[model samples]
Target: MAGIYLRGKTWWGRVQKDGQDLRQSLETRSESVARGRLKVWLDELEALAWGGKPRLTVNAAMDEFQKEHGPTLRPSTVRRYGVSIDHLDAFLGDKLLLTVRSSDLKDFETARRTAGASAPTVRRDLACLSTVFGFAIEKEWADINPVIPFLRQRAKRGLRESPPRTRYLTRAEEARLIESALPYVADAILFAIYTGLRQEEQFSLTWEQVDLARKHVTISAETAKGKRERTVILLAPALAVLKRIPRHLKSPFVFHHGAATTTRGARRALPSASTKKDNDGERFNHLDRGLRNAAKRAKVPLLRWHDLRRTHGCRLLQEEKWTLEMVRDQLGHRSVVQTERSYAFLEVEDRRMAAHGPGTNPGTAAAQEIDNATGEPIAAQKPAQGRRTDLEKLKKSTA
Candidate 1:
C-alpha cells in the first residue's frame, strides 16, 4: 500500500508505481505533520505518473478555476471574483499551490487588513483563494485545503465584521425628499420605501412582473440575488405610486428616464470614443444625479438610494413590528438571520417596552423618539405586529 510509515523516529512515504519502488523522507518526526507531507508527496507522485504538472502555481490554479466555473456564474459575480483574484494573486500567484501553508494565508489576511481592506473584503479574498485551493484539490494537484482550516481558526478568534450601515429615513425626511425629487425619481423613492426592493430589482422591474390586483410583485429567480423566486408585497404607498405613474407606450420598463433633451457639450467633448450612449425610454442603470440633486434640495446629508430600501425595512419592523422571518421574506433575503443582522437594532425599543410592561407602547407612552435621519424629535409612529392579520389591518386603515 502507498502510504506513510514511521521508520525509527522519522516519517517516510512509500509508493510503488510502474513497477518502480519510490520512497521519500517526510522530514518531520510529528505524526500529524508527516501525514500532511506524505499526502502532498503522494499527490506529486501520482501527477508525475499521469504526465500532469507535479507543481501547480497559485495563479495557474486560480485561472483554471475561473475558466471552469466562470461561465456558470453571473457576470457581476465573475467580475467580483476576478477582483478578489487580482488581490490574492498579488501575494500568492507565483507560489506552488501545494507549498502554501495556513500560516502564509494568515499573513496574507493580516497584510490585506493592514492595507485598509475592510473585513468583508479580506473575507471575500480568502473565499476566492479557498475556492482556488478546492479546485486544485479536485484536480489532484493539491492534497489539502489550507485555507479552510485557517478560516475556521480565524472564525474561532472572534474577528468582528464591520458594523452594517443603519441609515434610514424618518417620515418628515422622507416627505421632504420625495417633494424635492424629480417626478420619476420621486415615484421610485416612494416605491422603494414601501417595497424594500434592491436597486437592481427596482430598476430592472417591468409592468409584467407587477400584479397590482394581487398587491405584490413577483421577483423572477433569474433576477433575484439568491437565485430564487420571491414575492414582494405591495404596501398601500407602493401600490399608489405604481398606479399613478404613466406607462410609456413603447417602453417595457416601469421606470424609464423618458428622453434626454438637455445638451451635455462639456461631457460630450471630453472623449467621443470612450463615451457610451445611454439607452433612453428603457431601464435606468442609476438615478444618482437626480437623487443627488433631490437630497441637496431637501438638505438631507449623505443620503443614498439604498437608504430608501433600508427605510422600508426599518419602517416595517419599527412601524409595523413584523417578525424577522416576515421581513426576511419581504426583503427577499435567503434567511431570517440575514434580516435580523440588518434590522435587529430596530427591536431595542421593543425590548425596552417588554422591560416596562406588556401593554406599554413606547412610541406613544413616552415622548417622540429622536429620528435617526434628521436628528429631531418626531411624532410617534404607530406600530403593528405579525404578518397576515397586520397586513389586512394596514390595507383597511390605508383604504
Candidate 2:
C-alpha cells in the first residue's frame, strides 16, 4: 500500500516494500493524478518512486534555459532575460526547485521593489522566472511551478501596470529636434518618424532591406517586433530623406555613425565592413546623449525614440485622415485594439481642434461648422469668434 499527501500544491507519496522505505513527490497537484501515479508505481517498476523530481538548483535551470532557448529570441530580449537571471540568481542562489515557496517569491518581489525596480519591471522579471520554471517543468527537473500561483494571487489583488504614455511631437517640434540632432542621430530620428519604426528596428536597418527602386522598405520577419514581415511604403518625404542619406563606401548600415572627436559620452568609430551584416543582433545603441542634446538645442519637450513612432501615427491619422486599419497595417501592430488605444486620441483631438479652429480654444466651434462628411470642422483663415451653443444663441437673439 502507498500513501500520498499534498505539499504546497504538489502530491508526495510514501511507500514501503520489502522492509525498505521510499518517499517521493507524485508530481501533480490533483488528487486524481496522485492516486493514478501511486497505483502505477505500486503495480509496475522495480524501483518504487519518481527518483524524487531531480534535485536541481534555480541557477542551474537558468543555465540550461540559456543554452536551450536563448538563441531563438531577439538579442534585446535575451539581454533582458539575462538581467532577470542575475536578479533571481542573487536571491535564489543554490535553492532547490521543489523547496521554493510562494513566500520566497513574495520576498523576492518586495526586495526587488525596495531595490528601486518599478512594479512593471519587477513583473517582467517574475515573468522571465516563470518562463525558466516552465522550461524546467518540460525537462522534468521541476514538477510544481511556484510562480504561477504567486502571479495569480497578485493579479487578484490588483497589482497593476502603469498607463501607456501618449507623448508625441508636433510638426514644428519635430523639425527643430531633427535640425538640432547630430548627423547620425538626425538620420535615425527622421527614419523613425517617417517609417514608424521602433528604435531597434530603425537603428538596425541594413542596406539589404532598403529597396529605393520599389519605393518601399522591408521589415523582415525576424527584425520586426511583431515577428511578422511588413512593408513600409516610402512616401515623398521618406524618399527624399532616404535619397539625401550619404552613402558609405564599405559599411552596410543605412545610417552610419561618423566619428568627430573625443567627447565625454559621444561617438566611437565603427570598423568598416565589406558585406552587409544581416545578423539578428541589436545595433550599437548610443542615442541617449545625442537625443538629450537635440532636445536641449531645439527647446522642445524631450521625446523618446518611441515617441517618433507615435508622431508618425499622429500625423497620418490627424492630418492625412487614414483609417485605423490602414494605420495598424502600416505600423505593423499586432491588432487594431493597440492601434486604436494608443492613437485614437490623436484623431479625436484633431477633430476637436478642427471644430474650434486651430487659433481658437479647443472644442469652441459652431456645430454647423463641423463637416458632416469628414467629421472635421472647416477652419477659417480669419479665426471666427467662438461659436455659442443654441441656448446661448436664443438668449442673445431674445436680448
Candidate 3:
C-alpha cells in the first residue's frame, strides 16, 4: 500500500513493499495533487517491474551499436569513439539501460570530473550516450532517452575553452627538419608542406590522381575528409618533389611500398611484391621515429605532424598574392572560414609586410633623380648679380 503524508510541512509519498519503507518527495503542497502524482509514479514503477518485456542492458546495446556502425566512421574517429565507450562501460558496469535515472547520469558526471576529465571530454561522453540511447529508442529497445535532457543541460553550459595555440616551426627550423629527415621520408614531408595534405592523404596519394601537365592532384571523394572530391594545384616545389619519386611500372601509388588504399582499408590489403617487407616496415617505423628526431635535431619543441598542414595554410595566407578561397581549396577545407580562422596568425605577418614599403633599389633611385621637368639633373642656380655683371662686361667690351 502507498499513500501521501505530510512531513515538516512538505508532502511525501510513502510506500511499504515487503515490509520495507519507500519514500519519495512529492514536490507538491496540495494533498489531492500529491496523492494523484504519487499514484501515477507508483503505477509506472509497477508496470516497469511486472508488465513490460525484458529490456536490453546498456552494455549490450552499445556493443551492437559499435559493431554495426563503427566501420563506417574514419579510423581516427572510430578509435576515439571506442575509447569514449570503453570509459563509459568501465564506469557504469552492468547497469541496466532502462533503469538509468537522472541521478545515475549526475553521478557519472561527478566521477568523470573527479577523475580529471575536461568538461569537453565529459560532454563528448554524454553525447555518445545520447547517440546510443537514441538508437535504442528507434529500435524499440528503450522507452525514452535518459541522456537527452542531460545533453541539453551540458549544451547550455557551452563548450570549454581550448588550450593555447601552440607555436609552429619557423623557416630556419623547417629547413633543419627537412634536411634531417630520412632520405625516403623527406619528400613526403616536403609534399605535405607544399600541398597542405594530411598524413593520411599524403600516404594515400596515387600517381593516377596526379596530372603533371596540369600541375594538379585530384583527391578522390573516398579519400578526402569531407567525403567530396577536390583538386589541389601544385606549386613548382611540389612538382619538383613529385618528379623526384622513382616510378614503378607495376605500382601506381605515389608513395610506394605500402598498400595503396585508405587508412582504414590499408590493413586489409596485402603488401605488394615491390614492397620489400622488412625494408618497408623499417622505413615506416623510421618515418615515425625520424620525424620526432628531426624535430629535436632542428631544436623545434612540441612540433606535431599536423603542424605541417597548419604551416602550409599559414604560408598561403601570408603570401601577398594568395586569397582565402585559394587556401580553402588547397587545404581541402569545407569552408573559407575554417581556413581563415585556423590560420589567422598569417594575417599578422601580412600586416607586418604591408607596413614596410617597397625596399630601396639603386636603379630605381637613380632613375627617379633624373627630373622630368628639365630633362636633366637639377644643379644649383647661378646668382642673378653674377649673370648681370657678366652681361654688362660683355656689352662694354663690345662697345
- Using TM-score as the measure, the top candidate is 2
As for lDDT, the candidate ahead, 2 or 3, is 2
Q: Per-residue lDDT for 1-399 in model 3, tens only?
A: 898899887799988876789898988888989988798767766765675624456787899888988877666667778878988898774788888887898899889989998888887887788888888877767888888887676566753435546355555556657665544456777787778887767777788899999999998887788888899988777899888666655656777643211222122333233322332221121145556766665545687778877767766655435888988888888898887678766555556556864333211122223345678643322112212332344456555
Candidate 1, superposed: residue stretches over 4 Å from native = 1-54, 74-76, 138-141, 155-160, 259-278, 288-293, 301-304, 321-323, 352-399
- Arranged by TM-score with the best first, the candidates are 2, 1, 3
Candidate achieving higher lDDT, 1 or 3:
1
Model 1 lDDT tens row, 1-399: 588888999999887887888898988899899889877877877778777657778997888998899877755678889999998889999888878998888889899889998777887788889888878878877788888877777876754355678777756677667766656677788988899988878888899999999999998887778888899999999999889776877887888755221221111121223334535467787787777877777766798888988988887887787888899999988788888888777677678777887536443244234567889764422112122332344456555
Off by over 4 Å in 2: 1-52, 156-158, 259-286, 347-351, 358-399
Range of the 10 consecutive residues with the lowest summed lDDT in candidate 1: 261-270
Which tens-of-lDDT digit does each residue in 168-199 have in candidate 2?
A: 87655666676666555666677777788777
**How much lDDT does candidate 2 score?**
0.73
Reference-based lDDT, each prediction: 0.76, 0.73, 0.68
C-alpha TM-scores of all predictions = 0.67, 0.69, 0.63
Error of 1 at 198 (Å): 1.6
